[model samples]
Target: MSYAPQKRHSNRAKRWIITIGVFIVVQIIFIAIDGTFLEPSINDSDNVLAKTVRGVLESKLLTERIAPYSFPFFNLFLIVHVVAILIQALGDSISAIFAKR
Candidate 1:
């Protein structure tokens, strides 16, 4: 039996591991920023970033009436997840291009 299938599977698994690791790291960073800056600014009526964040959260998948406290966190998670996937794809593409050399 050939080992090509096993190698391919290993590579795919590595890619998933890298992606998930990146996602977790980035999510932690976002949470830190939220706790340090956004959470405090959220109560300040003069804070533009807070206002924009609230507007985006409310306009996208939630409304003020039904919006749970976790909605903003969910939004941040979605954004980070997509960004991690994109980073993984981009890294794979770059590696493949260089591998042809």
Candidate 2:
């Protein structure tokens, strides 16, 4: 019954989209710089997820020769952030879809 609350929530989601857009633009700039001027590579990543992945790989029986590749940490960070933002937008969109019924 309270439509005002829904309106406020819409504005919040819109703000989130805008913020994410800005971040995406910044990421594009960084990627451009990285590609055009410098060599981008993560030689030693301290990320917990990456460490876990390495652990799993090492634990596997036939993964001896299949070395753990260098994780593109910065690229992964950019990608995961973008994906998280999209996921938030997706959840909001899904909620709107159900309300339409």
Measured by TM-score, the strongest candidate is 1
CA lDDT of every candidate = 0.64, 0.60
Q: For candidate 2, lDDT tens digit of each residue in 1-101?
A: 76876786788778887877888697666666654436454334898976775565444332433222222434445556667878877987887677653
Q: What's the lDDT for residue 93 in model 1?
A: 71
The segments of candidate 1 whose C-alpha lies over 4 angstroms from its true place after superposition are: 38-101
Check candidate 1 and list the clashing pairs. none
**Tens digits of lDDT, candidate 1, 1-101:** 77775786588789789878877786676556653435533353768987887677667554444333344655555665687688878886786676532
* TM-score per candidate: 0.47, 0.46
Model 1 TM-score, 2 decimals: 0.47
